[model samples]
Target chain A: MTGLLDTLLAGLALGAVYALVALGFVIIFKASHVMNFAHGSMLLLGGYLTAVLHEHLGFAGALAAGVLATAALAGVVDRVLLQRLPQDPRAAHVATIVTIGVDILLVTDLARRIGGDLLSLGDPWGDRVRTFGPVTVPDSRLAAVAVSALVIGAVFALFRYSRWGLSLRCAAEDTEAAALQGIRLGRTRMLAWCLAGALAALAAVFLAAFPATGLERTTGQIALKAFPAAILGGLASPVGALAGSLVIGLTEAFVITYQSDLHVLGDGLSDVAPYVVMVLVLLVRPNGLFGAKGAARV
Target chain B: MSDAAKHLPRLTAAVVPLLVLCALPFYLESYWLRIGLFSMAAAIGAIGLSLLSGTAGQLSMGHAFFLAVGAYGYVWFSGDPGPGLPPVVAMVLAVLLAGAAGGLFSPVAGRVKGMYLGIATLALVFIGHHLMLTLDGVTGGFNGRSVEPMEIGGLVLDSGRDDLVVLGVPFGAEERLWYFGLVLLAFTWFTARGLLRGRPGRALAALRDSETAASVMGVPVARHRSSAFVVSSMYAGLAGVLIALSFRRVVPDHFGLVLSIDYLAMIVIGGLGSVGGAVAGAFFVTALPLVMAKYADQLPLVAAPGSPDGSLGPTEASRYLYGAAIVVILLWAPDGLHGLARRLRSRLRSRLRREPPAPPHGPGPAEPVTPAPTTTAPSVPVKEHTP
Candidate 1:
């Protein structure tokens, strides 16, 4: 029972981080209709910035700088690279593939800079644990859950109240209608990309915090697990993304916990457990659990 | 002009390339030949990917998984501690095995639409990687297994065999593999072209354009979608066999998401829905890094591998180039290199036929050459037409 509880707590923290990243995915998808494949690299960029600057600026300052820099980078990528292309709904898919190229370039440059060295982000919650009854949880994990909950709540509130959020929602519903309503589509799209980048940067801190060795080249790849999370919830649904992240998080945590019992799958099944759960869910619900069933008009 | 007169240039264009490729092994050194071999293998895989993603409008990221099935299947079926089948039979079975793997996944592949399908296929890469690592007996666990050299009749393709000299050049494993890769690539080219031009290709294009419309026209939507997966996997499998043969050893690490991304890049860079484009894209993508690394000394910005900390390495430079190319091509010329070639050819033809005034009703003669964004800006999103 303790083991199960411990695993569940760990899963919650993991899920929280995934939710942040998945929400980023949902935001980008809702705005531009292009899945930002460069998201992982963006997360890496944020983490890399924090790692490199923490020594000079202190942890908090570095974190802020990292978040701002990544947000700016995301905005530039949208404004310069993505926005230059015509917004043809038909060619939107091609535009999505272009993100892959951006990802490769960003990832390559970051990986080269890091180069087999694991650099710490100098986060305050270093190797500290707090006990709750029979279960002891790492402080970093607790911080992850708390920070993610706070951030995600703020995001949800923004969606519920902010003018940009309203414009985003409207644009997602009907681009033509939104455009006619004079909701600057281009600005909203850039803002959306910026928000997603900021969220990705925040997630990077908790991801590279205690328990994880440090930030490395492959840290960005860990963000890829969130792809299933975002997709599982349906790309357009924020609530779905949160729910999907939890499901994926719990699945991975449990899979790792019970690896010895389930030896037939070989070791390291937890690494792919989220994907397995995703496939099973997708097989049952094609558009994801909460995805709107699109109507086709000939 | 007579039909024969019209066909003469086309025939010469086709035959000349074929003859040149056939004679390349004798002329080129081992290093260049090896690159050609790898490029040919990549071309086969890219062709398969083009058929599935470009023609059928299914964005599959599980291509590497199918390629793995082909490669490992060949190794297990042909080598000891397993079936020990004939090399030719093993090769064929491997392709079938890959197709079977695709068949197994057809449930999701058939049901899922566009971007969703792409994400769904990603599961195959991670799951397949786990299986490859765990299934130690078959896949040789982490280290992987050395591939058995292909033996057909009395001729052994392995370097261990006695050397055969031809035209003062000693025929080695690279030389032997060059011909093998060529035959496989040629087979891929003709068959892919045949499929694209035949009934299935029309049906697939229709499916891509609009699934409901295609279904209304009696196209078996699910069957065709699933079968495209199978055919694509088979091609990936063939490519895997050739790759395994060239590599002499197969490792699980090589067949990862990066490989799938490379395949996608090839199809996109070459021009989606164009077979020749896939081949060209594959060669450019596969050769870029290799050629860059080889000539690192000559290049301005690039340093040799393991030179220093700050300088740009050849691998990094090539990646930057291709990555920038993908963005630039998509923005400037969405149709890709094949489209560019088509535009150039049309322009040349029009220039030669300048005496006749062009029809005003049709697309302007200069339009194709220029890659006018106005014409292609609103082609249609992948999801809009799919029900």
Candidate 2:
């Protein structure tokens, strides 16, 4: 019973971090229709910035700088590169492929600079654990949950109340109609990319925090787990992303914890478990759980 | 020009390149031959990817997984502690195995649309990687296994034993594999071109343009989509087999997402839906790193592979070039190298036709009185060039 509770708690923490990353995916896809394949690279870039700068500036100052820099970078990429693409929806795939290219470039440069060394992000939570009744949770895990909840709540509110969010929703609904209504598609997309970038930057801290072996070049790849999370909920729905992330996070955590029993599947099944769950979900729901079936125009 | 006159240029364009490729093995040394071999293998894989991603409008990042299936299938089928089938039979079975794997995934492939399909296929890579790591009996696990050299009626494709000479060049493994790759590539080229020009090709293109419209046009959308996946997997499988043979070894790590991305990059850089473009892109992507490494010291901004920190390595330099190429080409010439080539050829043809009869006694040809409009811009309609 204790083991199950512990597993569930760890899963919740993992899912919270994934929620941050997956939400970013949903926001980007909602606003721009391009699956930012470069999201992992952006996350790594933000984390790298924080790790490198935390020594000079305090951790909080470095974190702010990293978040701002990443957000600005994403916005610039959208405005300068993606905006130049043809407005046709079919061009979305091409833009997606372009992001893969951008990812390769960013990852390559980062990997080269980071080399084989692991760097510390200098987070406040450093392996300290808090006990609740019979359950003990790492401070970093608790911080991840708290931060993600606060940020996600703020984002949801912004979507509900902010003009930019309204414009984004409108643009996603009907680009032509939104343009007619004078909603700037370019600004909405840029803002979405910025928001996603900021979220990814925040997620990176927990990803590289306690229990994780600091920040390595390949830490970006761990963010790939969010792909399944975003897909599980449907690419366009925030609530779906949250639900999907939990499912994926729990699946991963349990799979890893119960590896001995699941030895038939193979070693390190945890890494691939999320993908397996994703495929199963996608098999049943091609558009994902919350993804709407696009009406055929022709 | 008359029909025959028009056919002359196209005929020469095709035959000239074929002749040059056939002649290459005789002239080139072992190092260059190996590069060509790898490029040929990449071309085959890229062409397969082009069919699915380009013509069929399905973006798959699972190509390397199918490739791994083909490679491991051949190895297991022919090696000891397995079926131990004849090499030739094993090769055929391996390709069929890859196609069968595709057929197995058809449930999702048939249902999913473009971007969704791309991410769905990502599952294959991770899952496939895990299986490769765990299935030591078949895949030989992490360290991997040596590929048995192909044999046909006691004539070994591997080196030394057969001791056959062609044109006194000393027929080595590279030389033998060169001809083998050429035959396979030629078959791929002709068949892919035929498919593109035929009815199924039209149906696939229609499906890509719009699914509902294609179904309305009497196309079996799901069947065609699955068939494309099967055929593409077969091509990838064949490429994998050829690659395994060329390497004389197979490792699980070789067929990963990076390999799939490389194929995607090749087709995109070459020009989507263009067979010749895929080949060009494959050769460029596959050979660039090797060539860079060979000339790393001579090239500016590129250092040796393990050079001190901060300096750009050969592999890194090539990656940067291709990554930038993907961005720049998409921005400037979305149609890729094939489109660029077509435009250039059309411009050249127009220039030749418009060359005001060389001034009788002038040392150089006279400039046209009116400013000749640039024909290089993709926007300029190449009406006369279109078939």
Candidate 3:
């Protein structure tokens, strides 16, 4: 029972980080209709920035800089590259593929710079653990859960009341209708990308903190796990994304913890457990759990 | 002009290139021949991907999984630890196995659409990788298994075989494999073209344009979608067998998501929905890094393969170029290199005829060039939903 509880806690922490990244995917897909494949690289960029600058600026200042720089880069990618494409139905698909190209370039450059060396982000919660009864959890994990909840709550509130959020929601509903209603689609989309970028950057800190060795070139790939998370919830649904992340996180944790029992499936099943869950889920619900079933007009 | 008179130039154009490709192995060194082998294998796979993603309007990120199935299947079937079948039979079975694997996954493949399908297929890669690593008996685990050299009658496609000289050039494994790759490529080209022009191809294209309309038009939407995937997987399997033959060893790492993306880049760069484009894109994507690595020392900023100074390497340089190419091509051209080449050919033809240049956009005067139905026909009017 205690072991299960421990695994559950770890899964919840993992889910929180995944939620951050998955929410980024949902926001980008909602506003622009383009899946940002460059998101992993953007997370890497933010983590790299924090790692490199933490020594000089301290952790907080460096993280702030990283978040800002990443947000700016995301905005620039949208404004400069994606926005320049001709307005057409295929444009969204084209833009999504273009993000893959951007990811390649960014990952290549970052990997070269980092080489085989692992760099620490110099976060304050270093190897510290907090105990609650029989449950002992890393401070970073607790911090992750706390921070993610706070950020996600703020975002949900923004969606509920903020003017920019209202415009974003309207644009997501109907682009032409929102435009006629005086919403600047370009600006709204760019801001959405920026917000996603910031979220990705924040998620990077907890991802590289405590239990993880440090920020490495392959760290960005961890963001890929969130793809299933985002897709599992349905691309357009934020609440679905959150629910999906937890399910994926828990599945992965349980698989890893019970590897001996599931030996027939193979070693290192946890690495791919999320994907297995995702495929099973997709088989059952093609549009995802919360995805609206779009009716064909013609 | 008479029909034969008008067709003479086109026939010559095709034959000349064929003759040149056949003649290449005799002149080029093993280094270049190996590159050609890899490119041909990639071309075959890219064509398969084009049929599914470009022609059928489904995006798949799980291509590498099918390729792995082919490679490992060939190894297991032909090698001692497993079935120990004939190499040729093993190769055919491997492709069929890949098709069966696709058939197994058809439940999801038939239902998932567009971007959702892409993400759904992503699961296959990871799951496939996991299986490859654990199923040590068949796949030989992480180190993978050595591929058995293909034997046809008396001729062996291996370097250890009896040496034969032709035209003062000693025929080696590379030389023998060059011809094999050529045959496979030619087969791929012929079959892919036929499929694209045939009834099934039209049905698949219609399905891609709009699911509802295609179903209304009596197209078996699920069947066509699933069959397209199966056919695509079979081609990937064939390509995998060729790749394994060339490589002599099959590792789990080679068949990863990155390779699938590389195939995607090839089809996109070459021009989506065209066999010729897939081939061109394959050559461009596959050969670029090898060529760059060979000339890395002379290049401006590119460091050699493994310099410790952290400078830009040839592989990294090629990646940057192709990555930028995908973005730039999509942004400006959208139709890719095949489209660009077609436009250029049309312009040159019009100029030679002493007529004014064709309009900047839209199809040029219908030449006797390969009929690209996807290019001329308007795409099905269906609004894409973000599900």
Candidate 4:
């Protein structure tokens, strides 16, 4: 009973992180018909930035600096690389991969420049592990869950009620029609990239903070697991992303905790375990658990 | 073949590599020979990837998984002690097992394409890496298992012998490995060339152009796509076996997502659908890094744990190089080096003469290049006819 609760709690924290990453993907895909392969890398950048800021500059400053830095990077990357893609809309996919390539290069260089022995968010949460009923989860995990939920709720409200959100949606639904309606696509896309970068940064920061200070290749591995969640939730559905992430998170936690010797399976598989569930779900429902079908495409 | 490719004007151009290799043992140092041998193994893998990604239009971010399957599968099939079977049998079995794995994984592709498909392949790489580390009974995991030294007709090659080394320096088992790698390269090249020029290859290319249209035109899109995956994986497997034989060992770290990305990068650099492009891409990528790390001595900013300086490492720069190369090629020559070479050759041939404009085959344009997805087709009447 205790183990199950613990897994669920940890899973929810991780799932919330996945949801944030998936939202980043959805935001870009919705706005530009562009799949940001750099989404994960962006998240990594955010985490690393936060780590540098928090450890080297202090926590409050790091948080602000990470967001600003990533948003700037995202805007520049979007404008310089993705903006000049071949006119043929079908060519967007190829261009997307290229942008991803660029992001990878950028992140790698950054990581190299900020050389360190290990990766860490450099948080001081470990000394205080609190217990509630059957669950004994860390403060950081609890904090991540709260933050993710708050962010998701805020974004949902903004999209549902705001005029700007409506305009962005209209643009995503029909680029030509939206252009005629006077929607500024450049501004909308720029906003989307900035928001996406912010979300990725927040996720990476909280995720790194929860367990330890830094990350390794395992950080990207975590981001990779979010693919299934993104797929399952419907690539365009933010609500689906959150839901799908929970399912994936719980599934991985359960499987590893109960199934065969996990130690042998290696740490890499644990990072990707949720993808197995995602793949199985996709085999049955291709559009995803909550994908709005045609509405998801531009 | 294109108009230029049809006439074999430069047969000696192709024979030059064979000549160089035949003479290389005498001139080059053993260390360089070893690098060349490794390059050949990687080339074979890249050629296979080029077929799957370039010709078939399927992107795999986890080909190293197939390579791992081939390597570990070979080791398992060999005698339980490790390096179980004769090296040749192990190699062949690896190919078959890899094909089987590809076949099994193919169905998942039917449900997804683009980044989703890439996700699946990426999953495979992570899974394979884990399996490599965990399956200690067969793979020997972190410690790994080494291939037994070569035994040619009961005359065991002396591993400790210095005289047999290629360039007055001791090469150990590399000489034997090179011979094996060359044989496999020949086989890989033959298979890729034949497959790319055949009906299946055409079908693959057609599907790449437009999947729904390809299906409408009676091509079995799923089957061909799956089959391409299978064949490409088989090539990766054989290459893996060669790699294992070369190292006489296999490690989980050896077949990771980085390698998968590197393989994909090579095919892109080489040109998507050409066998020659694959070889050229492989050599360029493999050689550039080797030359840079050794001769250029450019250090990576962050030294990976194993490095001496704690400053920068070759491995880190290698990734940076590949990532930058991906961007450069995509932005400039989306068609890759093969595309660049073809264009250059065409321009060179036409440079001297101000020939009269040739009659166009389709649209009567002066330039006969067939740019895909031309918007201004004779289908103007369809728009007029539409309500």
**Top DockQ prediction, candidate number:** 1
| lDDT tens readout by residue for model 4, B300-368 | 354544666435566667667766777787666655677667667666555432255544453344344
- Write down the DockQ of candidate 3: 0.62
Candidate 3, residues A1-298, lDDT tens digits: the string is 8899999999999999999999999999988888899999999999999999999999999999999999999999999998876444444666787898899889989998988988899999999998899999999999999999999999888888999999999998878899999999999989999999999999999999989989999899988899999999998999989999999999988988999998988788898999989989999999999999888878
Worst 10 residues of 3 chain B by lDDT: B378-387
Query: For model 1, what TM-score does chain A reach?
Result: 0.98
User: TM-score of each candidate?
Assistant: 0.95, 0.94, 0.94, 0.84
lDDT of 1 by residue, A202-290 (tens): 99998899899899998888778999999999989999999999999999999989999998878888988899999999999888989
TM-score, candidate 2, is 0.94
Assess each prediction's global lDDT (C-alpha) against the native: 0.88, 0.87, 0.88, 0.72
Error of 3 at A28 (Å): 1.4
Candidate 2 residue pairs in backbone clash: none
Superposition error at B269 for model 3 (Å): 1.3
Over the stretch B1-387, how does candidate 3's per-residue lDDT look in tens digits?
999999999999989999999999889999999999999999999999989988888888899999999999999999989989999999999999999999999999999988889898989998899889988888999999998998888788988558888898998888999999999999999998899889888888888777789999999999999999999999999999999999999999999989987887788777778888889989988998788767766778877777867787787887787678778876665566776677677667655654455544534443434335454322211121100
After superposing candidate 2 on the true structure, give the runs of residues whose Cα lies further than 4 Å from its correct spot. B1-5, B305-307, B353-387
Each predicted model: what fraction of the native A–B Cα contacts (within 8 Å) does it retain? 0.71, 0.56, 0.70, 0.40
* RMSD vs true structure, all candidates: 2.7, 4.0, 3.9, 5.8
Q: Record all residue pairs in model 1 with backbone atoms less than 3 Å apart, i.e. clashing.
A: A89-B381, A90-B380, A90-B381
The digit string of per-residue lDDT tens for model 2 on A165-275 reads: 899899999999999999988989999999999999888899999889788999889668998899888999999999999999999899978999999988989989999
lDDT of 2 at B311: 90
DockQ of 2: 0.50
DockQ of candidate 1 relative to the true structure: 0.68
